[model samples]
Target: MNNLFLRNQLCVPVKGYNRAIIYDILRKDYFLIPKEHCAILDTNDFIQFDKIEDVEEREELIDFLVNEEIIFQLSTSEQKKHFKSLNRNFENPNPLTNVIIHSNIDFRFLDLIKDQYLLNLSIISQEIDDNLLAILQKVSELEIDSIYLYIENSNIEKLDEYKKLFANYSLIFSVNFFNSKKIIDKTQLSQNIYYNFFEEEFSTYKRTLSIDKLAINAEHFLEAYNFHSYYFAKVYIDENGNIKNGLNNLENFGCIKSLTSSQFKEIISSSNFKELGTIKKKETLVCCDCEYRYMCVDSRVPSKGKKHWFHQFECVYNPYLSKWSNEEGYLNLEESGVYISASGCTIDQEKLSENFDKIWNT
Candidate 1:
């Protein structure tokens, strides 16, 4: 008890003054305690604190924090920090590559990522037309391993034609219907074309990184969490033939006619491009408190609501309350308080405003 010290963890404040969160990085657990109790974590030697004023039960909070490994006894005074290993590159020879190609009813001019064996492609099209076959043909030529076509399921008038055409490409294609569309056809489809079926709303998160995915890819994800992109390396050709960081992000990087895969990569790697993209859950508001932050597939371009950090307005989980709603939960993100735009952990006000301006003006 005497030798124990609070482990290095992340402390964040919820919007309301009532609650705050302490994320224990070592154990990958989070605790919601009173905002007043946050001072206990401020000092290196928490043992020096005798009383926490606002807390009704100080001992209880301490006991819970200790039990959660948020507080632990160090074996020595070394104060050493641990880092993740970077030795797995040699193991993955071919490497798994995923990309998204957004075409505005045209795929004839598409040319990017020509060399890599694409493991996945998510195509977002305004309408299904004759060019689709050309796109699929090009995909097959590119040796694209699998695909998920996002379109209005009900609007698919050529189901039979689609079945026949898609069958020829030999792609493991899934259809994601937006606008709350359901698979009404009731047709027993072949093994190749899978339906995007969600028994519940939480299942929607399965398409992104969720708990189940975290359990499987924890080690790999932990090492490469920064590379997580909501659009997943999208090379979008908007309806107007303009290219942006992603389909969700409107900031125009260049025109589809001029940009190449290599150029697209360079643009994304630039500071201006990264300023708008490359946000991880841990860097976000409430998402930082979740135990699954590292493993979760986060959104790069979520709806910009009232708060910069509260990107997921439809989120059901409330980390501060440690509760979830069947419907929309509280959406206030725990901002780092440094930036009015967002916390320092996320994009700053300067970068955010600049990107938005660039998107509108460009």
Candidate 2:
């Protein structure tokens, strides 16, 4: 109980944030060095309990890490119990993963519902036939556990209808909208819908979902095995009915319409399918060390040659430099010495003044 031992965890320096992000790979837990903490005992070196400073601050951090299972007290029995549960899960990996199919064709949703899988119907249009009809049909015919419908701001009108329709199996509706818009009161709408305004062009600092909290809430992390973030382990049925491993991914397994269960096994059994599905953040460039890696929903296919293996222009932080970069277009002092316009554009002052003049005149 006196000695503390570091687990087989990797503490790597993040490229964009300059903070060391710890990956408890065996347990699949991730953590950023807490800002208030003064030190992270050089975990790269096996932490010797006696050698540590033993200050209240240091002890507090040590206690926190021990509890997190990143490192554990040698005599602690809880860590071993946690490890056993995680190892069992890792060994008997859940083959079924949720597929998010964005389709213009409504009937195609029927084909993907045969399994007791979580299906996210990212319906392109808001003003379509009620999702409840599809959900009700699926519930009656097939054995599905959960069904989600992603809609736009325009679909607010159909909310009441959705509530009555999906009342049975908890069919949720996720939307991209603003709170200020006040299309519907959340207290009432939450009965059948969930709002995800994460993609809204809204803020300075964005937030990623919490992996640990997700595990706590969902019982298991739905994203624990998700690697590429695109349709990696899951399936993506395109608008053209071509079944690909991911959206916008060219590697088509085959058309969904003609795919039998036998053909489905063969498609997913190929090396290419399995290879793309396992490309984790640890294998990615800047993201390899990012604390947000495991929690993030990164579309790896977009960032192949770019600076980061996720999205480059979308990223505001440089982990190696540890400085949050400026607006996407406006050049920084380190990059270019020239001053930028007030609008955050890298344009000359004369045009900026002209824009100001037009605004004032109007």
Candidate 3:
């Protein structure tokens, strides 16, 4: 699938630590793109294609998805047939112009040339099965523009294996934040080992680190990852918080914070961060009212009773927050007037297509 579709979305692991917390951040801050941004589609969303009946219905859905500019994954000939059924009327083309096939099917069946649709292989983490050699062999055959390597806390030691496997491909390492070290003590032996290991291995691969809760000083973390060129901030906060337009409130309150999306845009528009590429800033906004608003920058708050930061926003599993109840002390995001969320790591697919309309669209 095209990387553009999955640009702003966070692809999280269902089994990772603090999964609930991470997902909560996603629910509040991120909007879902349709089939065109196919890179972030999980197994559950892909299965929805099975329920789609008739070419017309499929085509309609595809039309809706195309506005989102996401690539849809059609793994089988049967799926492709369904897709083709919708495209019978070539006058109105299927919005989902890009199709991704991830099965172990022969490449000949794809019938795709370089000038046409893009093709990518879904490398299952388990499929690696401790066989580094097999993984490397498979990587050699892939014509993928990027490889997604799912890295877990337990598998940190095995990352070297992946580095060697996809040495030839442009690898985007997705690190799960379970047990992620929030504090790296250079003086400590364990920290030293990890720092050395990551500094060396991640030097070659474009690292995209996923964290459940952003650190207190998120900018520091961003710098630590070398601004990664790509990073997903999955920090959570309570829904019942005061909503503001910029970081002025926090700064006025004596907080040493970085620029907000609007500020960042102004800076970039004026040729600031020129060293950081021609960065374009886009934001999604949400509004809420709570006493902790100033301290909670963009709904990212430190976990209650724990000094360590944890997600406290719209979590599907956490029934105590917004999307569950509207009682005071609980989040009621639907009631919030305006909330701003930003993504600048990839191309502005939302602007390019209108399949998905979010709060920030206007």
Off by over 4 Å in 3: 1-122, 127-136, 158-330, 334-362
Candidate 1 per-residue C-alpha lDDT over 45-122 given as tens digits, one digit per residue, 9 for 90 to 100: 434345655454766766776676566665555642441223222122232255556544345334555666666777
Residue 272 in candidate 1, Cα distance off native in Å: 3.4
The CA-based lDDT of model 3 is what? 0.27
The lDDT for every candidate, in the order shown, is 0.50, 0.47, 0.27
Error of 2 at 335 (Å): 5.0
Please list all clashing residue pairs in model 2, or write none if there are none.
15-319, 15-320, 16-318, 16-319, 16-320, 17-319, 18-319
Better of 1 and 2 by lDDT: 1
Please tell me which predicted candidate would have the highest TM-score against the true structure.
2
Residue 58 error, candidate 3, Å: 52
For candidate 1, the lDDT comes to 0.50
Candidate with more favorable, higher lDDT: 2 or 3: 2
Candidate 2 lDDT score at position 192? 52
Q: In candidate 3, what are the lDDT values of residues 76-166, reduced to their tens digit?
A: 5354333321111112121111122222323332222223222223232323344433553545453444433323233545645534544
Look at candidate 3 and tell me the lDDT of residue 213.
Answer: 27
Winner by lDDT: 1
